[model samples]
Target: MKKAVLINDTTYDYHHGCEAVVSGIKSSLLVRGVEVIASCPVGVHYKKMNNIEKAIQQSDLIVVNGEGTIHHGREKAKWLLEVSAYAKKYNTPSVLINATYQDNPAEFDKLLNDFDLVYVRESESYDYLKQRGIEAGFAPDLTMLLSQTISLPEYQSRNGIGITDSPKVQEGMWNFQMAMKHGWTFLPVLRSYRAEGEKSATEVLRHLKHLFTNIGWINKENGVSEESYLRARNRFLCYTVSEYLKKVSGLQILLASRFHSLCFAIVTETPFLATSGNSYKVEGLLRDVGLSSRICELSDFDDIADYNAYSFSDEEKIKIKEYKKSSLIKINNMFDKLVGLTG
Candidate 1:
């Protein structure tokens, strides 16, 4: 059997979206008859180079699942640089998947040039890599693969509205006002999980450091906690990805600033208004599936009624379904090529 080492540095203890992305990649590989080895599990630091190198050496292919992590100066970028370097030194066929590039093109020259294939999830990153003379392919986010493996729950919609919190956009008050005006049940979906007393002292200290480092950006007076702004809503927060998906499936509409919240809405076939967060990840995914019309700004909240009225036509739904199929095909074809190369 073919062996593949999947390296997603955040899969173990990240938000449900991260878990979904990792699971989607693994499911796609498993169905293709590949044995998977995850390089980074929760609580294990990526600095463990010996273990990572051993896994790469034992695998037929190395996959760097840089899920929106190739941005400038981010810790994930540093980790990618390290792993890509190891893959090169070990002479393994490596592929970078579902990554977004926000750093200078020059900084990524060596890493991008060394990869056997680079699959970017967003058009902006694709174009950026292309302009810098890197051969990059554009594909939808891997999370779309979840639609294939999971079935949407059957729930009666009571015209409920779901909203996600984002540091980049503070639309909590506006969303709450709209929910009240429309008499829709308000749901706050927490994308990331916070462990109360389950973490070690070092981990807790790291989290506290992050909280204080970004204190200016956090709105404590608005009841937005340091952990996540969604805590302010505190009404109905879905902790797990499954819960979030079921909650979104039941909602008539979602006003989401989190990227994965939008992903869940898409998978659940729930209509939503997406606010662009700190990056183009949200708008880029919508544009890829021909749903750019759903993009909304904070100011657009004043006309929430118009957005609530918007619904996807049967043709549009078909387009999304077809696009999802194509995405899975792309992933499978890439792996096939890798297997052929390694074989």
Candidate 2:
């Protein structure tokens, strides 16, 4: 069996949407009969370069899960560069899967050139890399592929809104308040990892301290000091990707700020109004699906009602279905070439 090492931004944290991306990549590799040997988070794995080198030496391929990691942020991008360098040194084939780029194009060109193949999750990143003279192909986010196999639970639609809260946007709180004032049964959804798999007692305590400290202000504002208001409102806390998708499928609409929250909305066909966060991933994705009008900036909260009233057209649904088919074919073709899989 051809051995592969799967590296991602965070693999063990189930709370983050990237966890689902990792799962999807691993599933795709396994379906191709590749033996996945090492799976580790980039932050923790980069500290032990010697171990990474050893793993690369033993593996036939180095598969990096580049889900939105190649942005202006120095940390994750630096880690990917180092990993690519190690793969090149070991003369092992490497491929970056389902990535997006928002940083220095020249730097990305140099880094991506080291990989044998590069697959981006959206056109913006694909064009960015191609314009920089790097050969990159476009593929949909891996989570969409995973969602294809998932069987969502049948639930009666309550016609209520679901709100995903992020610390990056203060206006998200106002949106939440508005939902409550309107008596909408808004489900609070958290797409961030909350350290649920920490093994050490000290680590657990540290995570709890961090979580409470961050959300304590919101609790105070709501006059609920005993527990976090966000925590109390969260309907999908600590849920696996499958469970989260099933839960999201029941919602009538979604108000999302996080990129993956928008992905879930798309996968479930749940109409959503998105607020821009730290990156253009959300806007780029909505534009790709012909739903650019669905994007609402943080300052545009006053127009929330207009956003809520928006619905997907039959033509848009048909477009999404066609996109999903073509995207999956691209991914499957990549895997077949890499692992020599016959289907």
Candidate 3:
């Protein structure tokens, strides 16, 4: 079996979205008979460089989960640079998977050039890597590929809605604020996984306490049992924010702040609208789907009813299905090409 090492510093403790992304990458690789070993930047602090070095020595390929570096921050940029340098040392078939586009330092650019295959989720991102002269291709998000496995329960009730910690909400309140405009009861599901002394959690909890009467906060501080995790998996509606689309399949509409939430919405065939978070990549992905109107910028929500004026007809439904099919075909083909699985 070809051995592969998955590198991502993301954990499920707080970022459930990343947790799902990692899970999707691993699950997909496993199905192809790839012996997969996973590691994160946090491991570097404890196991030291020797741990990743040893894995690199034994692996046939190195897959870097690039979502960790989309933001404009020193720490994220540094992490990308360090990981790239380490991966290059092995001369393995290194692939940067599901990364968003971001401006980085010269060293970061140099590190990107070292990849054997670079798969981005957006065409704009494909253009980005090509501009930098990195061998790149576009693939739908791995999360979108895995969402196909979701079997939604019959939504027997319309009691609640869900949203994630997106700073953009304060600006684009129409999607969440104007819920009554479309005759659906909006129940906001708010979750927090902040560690002790984190003010952001406290602030979000305070605001959400008023916005949502029903909360689904998963406290990793309490720790997650195997049973709880399984139960969470079964309850499609209570899926992590990205999985929200699957859970709310029966709802008339979904409005969200997170990227995966919109993705879930499409996968579940649920009518949904979203406000862009701090990430422009989410906006770019939405544009690729031809649902740019679905992305309400903080500035665009000045009139929540604007979206109400748009027609939601069978034509729109056809568009959603076509988009989903096209994206999945590309994603699956990429996997086949990567593994040389041609029949």
Candidate 4:
């Protein structure tokens, strides 16, 4: 068996969207007869970890799950891309996938060439990589690969508009208020699966945060609008992946603020529109599908009726279905090339 080390195994986030990415990467490699001999989580710095070098040295492949981490040339990205340089020392092949390559330092660009393969999640990233002289494949975020395994449930009764959170906190609160003002559903898009009492310190901190945020005024950093904030946070606390998708698939339309929420919307074939997020991902993805008009701003919130009961257009439905289908096929091919399984 070809031993491989999966770096950036990001599944600590019990969020199903994140889980899908990790699962897609691992399963693709497994089917290729590659064994994940060891793995590393997202939080740790790989260079500082004493065992990382040994893991990389013993493996035939080093797979980096570059999910949203390669942009900005930050310390974390440097640590991740450095893996390619490290693997070269042992004559092992390294690959980076599901990445978003944006404005990064000119120096880090050289580090990219060492990868045997690089697959980006959006066109913008692919363009960026090509401009920098890296032969990178363009693929949608691996979360879409979930559509192949967890097929959309049979359509049944779907209810009113549902709103999800944002990378930006203020926008999240605004999302809650808008959902409440119209008596729509407030779907919390990202939540961990850990039981509440599992971590006492984390539990205590959450209680303190909730109590602190309940103090009336909408402090941009400290809090949001009145009771809606408290109520939404309480309701947002937990979900199994099954419950999360069931709720997402049942929504008539979802106004999303997070990138993964849009992925959830696509997989479930739920109607959705998205606002600006902390990164270019939302805009990049919508544009790729030729649905850039779906991008909305808070100023346009009241005018939401323009897209009421919005569903994908016949053309967009075709585009999205094809766009989504490519994710898995591309992922499988990336692995095939990695292990020389490409026929």
| TM-scores for all predictions | 0.78, 0.82, 0.71, 0.85
Pairs in clash, predicted candidate 2:
none
| Residue-level lDDT tens digits of model 1 in 184-254 | 55555443344322466775565445444432343434534334534335434555577778877777778
List all candidate RMSDs to the true structure: 5.7, 4.3, 8.8, 4.4
TM-score, cand. 2 vs. native = 0.82
Estimate, for each residue in 31-128, the C-alpha lDDT of model 4 and write its tens digit: 88888888787867777666777888888889998888887778888888888988889889888888888889987888888888888888888877
Candidate 4 deviates by what RMSD? 4.4
* Best model per TM-score: 4
| Candidate 2 local Cα displacement, residue 201, angstroms | 8.3
RMSD of 1: 5.7
Off by over 4 Å in 4: 194-234, 306-309, 341-343
Per residue, candidate 2 scores C-alpha lDDT tens digits across 89-194 of 7778888877887765466568777878788888877777777777877777877775567554454353666666564434445655555555444444443343
> Worst 10-residue stretch by lDDT in candidate 3?
230-239
- How many residue pairs clash (N, CA or C atoms closer than 3 angstroms) in each of the candidate models, in the order given? 0, 0, 3, 0
- lDDT scores in order: 0.68, 0.66, 0.58, 0.74
Error (Å) of candidate 1 at residue 110 is 2.6
Q: Using alpha carbons, what is the TM-score of model 1?
A: 0.78
Report the CA-based lDDT of candidate 2 relative to the real structure: 0.66
Worst 10 residues of 2 by lDDT: 189-198
Compare the candidates by lDDT and give the number of the best one.
Answer: 4
lDDT of the structure predicted as candidate 4: 0.74
